[model samples]
Target: MFCFQCEQTAMCSGCTGHAGVCGKTADTAKLQDELTGALIGLARSVDGNANRPTASTDEAMLAGLFTTITNVNFNNQTVQDMIDRILAEKRKLVPDCTTCGSPCSRNDDYDMNKVWNADADIRSLKSLILFGLRGMSAYAYHAMVLGYSDREVNDFFYRALFAVGYDYEMKDLLPLVLETGEANLKCMALLDKANTETYGTPVPTTVPLTVEKGPFIVITGHDLHDLKLLLEQTKGKGIHIYTHGEMLPAHAYPELKKYPHLKGNFGTAWQNQQKEFANIPAPILFTTNCLMPPKASYQDRVFTTEVVSFPNVQHIGEDKDFTPVIEKALELGGYKEDQPFTGINGGHEVTTGFGHGTVLSVADKVVAAVKAGQISHFFLVGGCDGAKPGRNYYTDFVKQTPKDSIILTLACGKYRFNDLDLGTVAGLPRIMDMGQCNDAYSAIQVAVALAQAFGCGVNELPLSFVLSWYEQKAVCILLTLLHLGIKNILLGPSLPAFISPNVLNYLVEHYKIAPISTPEADLKKLLAK
Candidate 1:
């Protein structure tokens, strides 16, 4: 029952004992580890057997990998069943090659301990690649749902899984690590294309912080496809859909937002759900991760789908039928009148949808403002928000930013200040919202373009990245940033416990990475430099 896979691990070390900080039981952790081991075995089998997976086999691999992601699944039985299925599929995929006299190494299950307990330097590099791929797989899984699949991305999953199990050296693992970033970049581009083509390019859309009165559904997690399905099913019903957590970006999508029932976002990041979802009259649907254990008051009303699951919560199956959730919302009957909700800062609403496409579309205007000296500095204040107290630095950092500075944010971390009315600076929104974690790709794109336009290195641009990480997706995004040699990133609320001293030193010396300090102090230093 030892787990250190997330930013909020117990005391910044590992989570052990009865339950994890995220409320995951020891049993659940063991199940996840078993699922991961089975996936490794399946990868090994694939090396021996050349035949393509049956539909169930493919589904098993996708769901099995996704299930082990932080905060995604919590059911021991489900995870074990998934592991069993993966083993069955492996047997089917490589039946004859098991007896070969030659030690054919095409497919073999890797012992995770090999990587987890390797030399600090090798382990750090491999962890970066493995976790990065895990995050990328989530994005790939989402885009795949919309019938937008990439051969390179999908094939790499197997290759990466194979590497995770293999006895590869640091030299061998390092390239794969960078390749994860490269592959993720492409995966994100595919998602951006899917989202833009399906929902139209996200424009500068302001989402309300206030939750409307009456019966409403607060949906969280990273699945827009599930949200879209719910939106379609709930159309014309009295039920109102409020985006929660990662789903906040859905408001920016013209296709999803066109529904009158699709209301504003309901709460902050995923970590606050224990309190946020408590005693709410409406049912909530979790389409993805960072799902903390639900409190008793709202547990009955929680609905899970896709790879996300909890012990007793009602699960919407493959048919995507949401009748149970709808019934729960109706049963709760909502508030007698419209209930009003406010953000952490007590703001009535927040703004979102300032994705790269939107920001870059107005690139000329932004550049003009910068050249004119109307915009003093640009701060990319974004990443996964956590419950750790130090996270307030983000809020204060944004608050203390100069009037002429622009704050560009993404992911749930923006919840800390998205509600703040920073107002416009030099004709551009002072606080710009780039779509979800994956949309970090968009930020990178804008940075590269700005560097090229200014005839300087990206590091030389008047831009700084103050990032907060909580999960594997953030891990992958950071690697992608490093792959491009973006330096001097301010990462906090704390550094990863999994990072050994030597590895940490390597990053500090090579990348000039540092943990965050007080907002005012950090702001002064960033600007002073």
Candidate 2:
């Protein structure tokens, strides 16, 4: 098996051998590759047959792609089943091809090796587009669950898949790569609108770090819909729900947080689950990615749903029945007394929900501060947090930020310093937690607004992006930033292994992107500029 799809890949290169760094077995990896190939085939069929897919077909495409995302699915059986469903959907879409006498490559599955082994430059660019779409699909899937679907976003998935399987030149592939960013931008907006419309626009809310006594459930992943259903089902039960990882943003959603039983956020990012969840006398539910293989001690306590799966773990199906998890939580009996936990920075509470809508609602005050030069610099410290030790850079960087500077963060990475009491700058919270990775859209919106207010390009605004990436969602968000010509961004703890030298050079020269150095060095350079 060979996989280089995430930040913590073996030794900063591809993961080879029987198991990936994320604990994905060789069989599961191959099944994911097969699932991806089948999706490409379905896309080819869609290209040939212009009719729209049925509801099942549409959902299969989304789930298949989402399953192949890093840390999402670890069950080979489930992945192969998804591939079979994709083939079945293709047959439904192009039944005539099976009976046709003429030779047809349109229905044939694409060998991903063709793109994986192509010229280094082409491979890098295609990886960007493919991985970006994988991330975008996850967001689209979540929005779709809530009855929010965009024709443009769904249509682009097929178009992007078709391009991945084609023999296109750099000129052709490059534009589509950027279009992935462009399409993702719209997809994120649709999700934002979906979330805000369904659950009121997130307002600034403080979430506790303490885990209350009694039976509690720690919910991870990026799906609020699943969290909501569980919250509804667990209402009036002794079970308490604590947001974990990407689900931390759920605390900011008015509709979800209205449940008095919905407690504070539980651990840091997804990578620390092995240590964090160990011996925890409660069941955990994963709604999306960054699921590492559960340790033997915690295996029974981990529950999976949606596209996230691990062999042997109890899976809650679409019926959204969570009795198994609830039973486990009750059996565990939880802590005898409330356990007071603090974040890495030792603060007992963290705040989030300063999304674009909330932040923009207070735009007048922020603008006035900027005009008065009271708030000197703005740092958007955002992206996924991982197990890598170097990720401490984020915590330290946020720690070292001046009191007068504003720090904007999103995604799971913000957990590193979200608990730090950074105070406020000119009446604005020094550290503002945007929503999830897709909420990068909110940060971009705030930046654009600031740029317009200052009468300059976004690059000229007193804002800098220090991003840390882990999975494909971060890839798409990074591409979106590049598409907007945002420059001098600091990206780390390491660059992608899939980025060949030439492609890396192109990004460095064109975008002025650089790998992160020490927190002090980076802060100096950022301030010097």
Candidate 3:
């Protein structure tokens, strides 16, 4: 088994031989590859038959790609079931393929190893396209949950999947790589609209880390729809609901916050879950990605929904019945007293929300602050977090930023310093938690609004993005930034192994994308510029 779709691949290269660094065993890795291969075949069949993609086709495409995302699904049986569903869908698309005596390979399953072993440059470009689609699938899936679906976004998945299966030249694959970014931008926008419209625009809200004494449920991942369902189901049942990981931002939404039992945030970020959830008496419900394999102590208490599946963990089906999760929480009974928890920085509480609506509504004050020199710059330091020790760079970077500069962060990476007392710049909170990675859309909006108010291009604003990436979602978000022609972005915790020298050079020459260095040196460089 070989997989290199994430930033934490073995030895900074591909994961091969046995288990992956994420605890995905050889068998499970192979199954995920098989699932991906079958999805490609289904895409090819749908493309070959020129059949309009139905909801099932679109959903299968989303679920299949989402399942292969790092740390999402670690269950071999569930992955095999997804492959079976894809094969069934493909059979419907091309009924004659199986019986064809001299069948062409156009619609056959792709061997992922072929791409992994392809020319370095071609593989780099194809990897960009494939991984970008996987990242975009998460956003698309969220939108679909809110009864929003874009035909252009759905069709691009099949087109991109077909390209991944074929031996496309750099010239052939390069356009689709950028197209993936362009498509993902729209996909994210769709999700943003869906979320804001469904849950109301997020507002700045401070959340405590203290778990009140009672039976409680901790819901992780980026699925707000699932959280709402769980919150509704657990209401009147005396079960407290605490948001965890990306769900930390869910507390900022007015619709979700209204629940009396919807209490405070629990753990720090996804990377810390293993340690944080180890002896926790509360049952945790994972609605999306960033699910590390559960430890033995807490394995039975973890519940999965949507595409998140562990081998033996209980799963909530499409009916969205969360009775199993609620029951587990009841049995555990939580802490004997109101347990106080603090963030990594030892702050008793952390604040979130401050999304585009919140920030942009205060745009006038922000503009005035800049004009008066109360705020000198804006730094958007955000992305996925990982277990790599080097990720401490983000914590240090945020710590070292000048007080005159405001820091806006999103995704799990913010957990590194979200609890830090950055203090306020002008009248605005110095560190703004802009929801999850998908809320990069909100950050983009705020940046554009700032630039427009200042009558300058986005790059011309006093803004810099110091991003840390771990998985495909980061890949797609980075691509979207490039698609918008944003320049001088710094990415790190190490560059992707898939980005061949040529591709990296292209990025450097055109967009000035650079791997991060020391926080002191990077801050000096950005400030001096």
Candidate 4:
């Protein structure tokens, strides 16, 4: 098996051999590839039959793509189940093809290894499209959970999937790659609307890292609806809920936070889960990606739902019945006394949910601060976090930002500095957490609003993006930024292995994309500009 779709791929190249660096075995990796290929066949069959795609088809495509993302699903049986479902969908589209004497491979499953061995330039373009779609599907899935779906976004799944299977030129694939970005932006906007409308717009909320004693449930991943459901079911049962990883933003929403049992976050970014969760006396549920392989120490305490599956783990299925997870939490009975936790920086608490609404509501004050020289620059320091060594660059970068500059951050990367008491500029927290990685939409919204208020383009605003990427979601977000013509972005711990020299050069020339240097050097360069 071969995989290279994440920042922490083996040695910054592809992961091959018996198991991936992320703990995905060769069998699981191969099955994920087969599942992806089958989904592409399903896409081709849907287009070939000239039938309007069914809702189930769209969902299957979304789940299949999302499942293949790094660290999401590690169960081969579960992945095989998804592949079987896609194959059935393909068969339904071409019922007679199974027994046809003259069979054409037009709608057959693709062998992904072929593309992996293709020319680096062509492979890079296709990789961009495929990986971008995988990331976009996560945002779309979350929106669908809240009963929101965009038809155009749904259709583009098939259009992009078919392109991946068919032989396409550089010209053809590049537009599709950008189209993936355009579609992802729409999906993210839909999710933002779904979250705000369903749960009310997020506000500035400070959450402690302390876990109160007794039975508690820790949940990670990007699903607010599931967190709400769990919060509702666990109410009055003495089971407190602590958000972890991407779920940290749930505290800011009015409807979700009203539950007194909904306590603060539990851990730093997803990578540290194995160590952080080893001895915890609470059951943890995963509702989305960033699920590393559970160690034996806490494997029995882990529950999965909404397409996140691992072998022998308790899975909360579509019924959304979290009874088993709740029971596990109660049985653990948490700590005997109040247990204190802190972020990577050792601060006792952190703040989150400074989304577009909260930031924009205070826009006039921010403008005044800028005019008065209380704020000299803005740095968007966020993205997916990984186990790579160089990631400390983010911690240092945020630490070294001038005291007067505001740091806008989102996703798991914020875990690096979220607990650091950076104080505030003009009554605003110096480092603002803007929900999940998908909340890149909120950051974009705030940037766009700042530009409009300042009467200039977004680039002219005193803002710089210092991003760290791990998986496909970061790929799509970066593409969206490029689509909006945002420039001078800094990305690290490393650039993607799939990006050919030519494609990298194109990005450098057109978008001014640069891998990160030292925090002090990059800070100086950004500030001087």
Judge candidate 4 against the unseen true structure and give its global Cα lDDT, from 0 to 1. 0.91
How many steric overlaps are in each model, in order?
A: 6, 0, 0, 0
lDDT of 2 at 430: 94
Stretch of 10 with least lDDT, candidate 2: 48-57
The total number of steric clashes, by the backbone 3 Å criterion, in model 3 comes to 0
lDDT accuracy of residue 362 in candidate 3 = 88
Q: If scored against the real structure, what TM-score would every candidate get?
A: 0.95, 0.98, 0.98, 0.98
**lDDT (10s digit) by residue, model 3, range 324-429:** 8888899999999999999988998999998999998989999999999999989999999998879999999988999899999999999999999878878789
The residue pairs that clash in candidate 1, if any, are 44-107, 44-108, 110-165, 209-349, 213-338, 213-339
Q: Give stretches of model 4 more than 4 Å off.
A: none
lDDT of 2 by residue, 122-161 (tens): 9888899899989999988988898988877888899899
Selected candidate, larger TM-score, 1 vs 2: 2
